[model samples]
Target: MTGVPLLDPEIPLPPDFPNRMLTHMFASPIETDIAPSGTLLGLLQRGRGDGWLHALAAPRPDAVAALNHCVLRDPRPDWQLEHRSLYYARLYRELDAPLDAIGEHLFDPVDALEECEQRTGLALSVLGHLVTAGRQDALALLRRYAVTGANWRWALDELAVREDDAGLRELGPAILARFPGTEAGERALIEAVRDSFEPRPWHLWAEDPARSGQRERLARALEIGDFDRWQRQLRPPTPQPGWSVRAVLDWAREGYEQTPRQWREAAAARCLGAVAGPGDREVLLRAAVEGPSPVVRAAALRHLAERGDPAVFELIQRAAEEPDEELAQAAVTAYARMNDDGALRQARGWLERTDELGRTAAVMLARRGSAPDAPGVLAALRRVVRTRGTDAKELRALVEGSARLAIGPAVPVLRHIYRQTISSQLRGHTARALAVTDPTFASGFAVECLWDCEEETREVAAHHAATADARVLDRLRSLAADPAEQEGVQTAVRGRLAPS
Candidate 1:
């Protein structure tokens, strides 16, 4: 006899497992017309608008299996960046799916190895939303998990947001017991009290006579936390108006010697700009080239560039050629800030070089380049993506630049990045770029984008997706009606559906 599969066969198992029974899931094929959800396994993987529609319409067991697989494994490329909890929770409520799979996943023996929030955050969050939807069973499960689960704090926070006062008060002893009775435990308890997101339970506990010792400890900790914040704000190396340009420079040098923070160095540069007289240009010039600290040199270069000093262009070029990476990046940033025609001329000249400076020049041109600069910007973007691939965070500026220049040729590259990149934010950027660059976007990618995990992507879809497809209109109407949908998205949907 064959051994039973751990999960239902129709559910798409995570790729980490090597079981012979495991079946890989792929996205449903997109066509000119909207297609019905066919295989439950594929519905679970694609997680598009069609996935939700299919999962809801499939057989009860198949739909439940698909829902459980998604909630337990979290199929999104980046959980921190993309949203799946609410999506899964809505499906769970629609199916009235049993919580056995979720319960087993949460309380599994393997939780010892995977005790962090990442493993169970999606399930807990879905349960949290279910509680908000007036599911009493979901609320009870959350309470049980909050008291006994490995990631209890997350559960407790969720309950704090949704559960009644009496419910939260009952959890005090269990949560407090996690801290030991010793002095170290008391300190830990104080920290927990100070850092709590929902302070109502702590406040109620602080007033209870039965827990006087814990209350006093928490009260003192809260006072100390406030005092610490005040002390931090009051103590500083603030700039004074009486300081001369040389004095401010010396102050910057001293601070750099002590702490060497980039923000502090930038503040020092602003101070120099405020105090410098006509006669101080020579000193500023010298500091840009020969300052002992790179921070000082960078600050001076930034100030000089912002002031549009004519000689600073040659100095910026020298700094870019310097072996120091930090200084070179600073020079590039300073050069980008220059609004003069010379900066544009110099950027065009640097565009041909295949160095870090060349990449920086390309980004600057993308941001500030005129309509005439589109071809050069597109060429630079192609080279950068070809060299670094779609995963490079550095390409974001160029991606926006392609949109700003409205480069039609860059549409294919943007679409490729949209499909290949794992970053939700990057995908959102790609969607906005496509909205402007590609004429077919309203009917093609925009339709699939309605099911995109990011709300911003959904907003883009609402604004641009063609409503000729039945699925598009249904999703748009649902979004418009849902109170949970973002106001911006709702507005877009309303505007799109409004009679012209």
Candidate 2:
């Protein structure tokens, strides 16, 4: 009663063992056959075909059940008891039975140690096998074993490799904290923490128990080796634990959504940079069309074309047809980087579909060889700037490069934006445009910019002034001496004003 003997009297404990393990020993070895249950067999197959027991090929479920029942009903003989008990343990693990159920019929640690004066070798073997099997139920069973500080070393080491990240982290730390001197104990502890943050690619699922830790693992993986692991893991396999395609997409979307307005633009940019694949193309296309931020939408549009996706051409055309000038401009920029007859035709068709302002934009973009110019492109650009509310900077910049091509009526509009615009930046740019045709016109804007309040205007003015006026040196010298002038303004004026 004290030692809680399990097998027949002929059966005895293996020689040379500690006593405490006997307390938790089984009294009656449970029955199991050479062949296990179908569920158990299937579980083994799923686990890379390795398991605690060798599976029987084409096993008879009835024979297995009969053998299992016989073992459970009778006390195993002395010589066969060790094998019998071990077999029972294996069956229990396979069937996912509770360890305490086995323990309740077996030895109790305190009383067994007082009477037996030796550990049960049978119990040790069962525990060791469970640790190595790495099955979830096996792990649960191993936790019930008599875990002395000495036994803790082997147990912790095995757990580090066989258990999931969370389990290893838990058991490994307990071993190290309780048995600081044992090398295996200490190593297991460190490995648990290290592997949590830097998981091996083959075993990401093994590390998912601690999601924050798993995230840390992913981040560390990205830094380790050109991110081949991240790229591989995140790619097709349809779905896997740590780096599934859909999960990554969702993660990036979440970040973009939660970020502050100022930061959302940057986050979306980074997300787009990281996410590019066939399936992701639609997501990016939708973002290009309907993203909340212009910056995000523009970048998505540009990258689609940059990625050399043929589908982007149609999307670009669709965006070009939108009433939003920003989207239209982005699509135009993307179109410029592309070369496709379809895109050109689409852009032209959309342009023809719009009224004067959009028509002018389309014609300006089309004239650059993007599409065949509508017979009316140049004339439309002129009319838009003259009578429409087109931005002067835009009209002038458009006219600057194209005016030399007998751009017709747009030339006068460019001159008008140049002379009438209030923005020195626009005026200076328009002036430079005019300089491309008539240097005198550029010189006039240059003088006007010099008298302007904005430093940028003065800089432009000085640059233009440097190209004109025989008395330029005198003008700069006089300006440099003026006490009212800022040092930067004086220096700029002096630099451009060559000495007589």
Which candidate leads in lDDT? 1
TM-score of candidate 2 relative to the true fold: 0.36
Cα lDDT tens digits, model 1, 271-299, are 87888877989999999999877777888
Candidate 2's C-alpha lDDT?
0.45
Cα lDDT, all candidates: 0.75, 0.45
Which residue pairs in model 1 clash with each other?
none
Global lDDT of model 1: 0.75
Cα deviation at 343, candidate 2, in Å, is 6.9
- Show pairs that collide, candidate 2: 6-27, 17-119, 18-118, 18-119, 19-118, 19-119, 23-107, 23-108, 23-109, 27-106
TM-score of each: 0.74, 0.36
Where does the lowest 10-residue lDDT sum fall in candidate 1?
Answer: 28-37
lDDT of 2 by residue, 1-500 (tens): 01111122322222321332233322333321112112333212111111222233225453244323323333222223213333444444445544443333223444334332122333434454555544455465445442442333333443445566555445432332442445664454344434342333214432445546444443443344344445666786322222433444344344445646222333333445565667877777787777665555666777777676777766776777787676677677766655555554554555544443355445445345322363345545554554443343345435544444544434455555543332334444455555555445434445544444344445555666645544445546755775544577687887676465
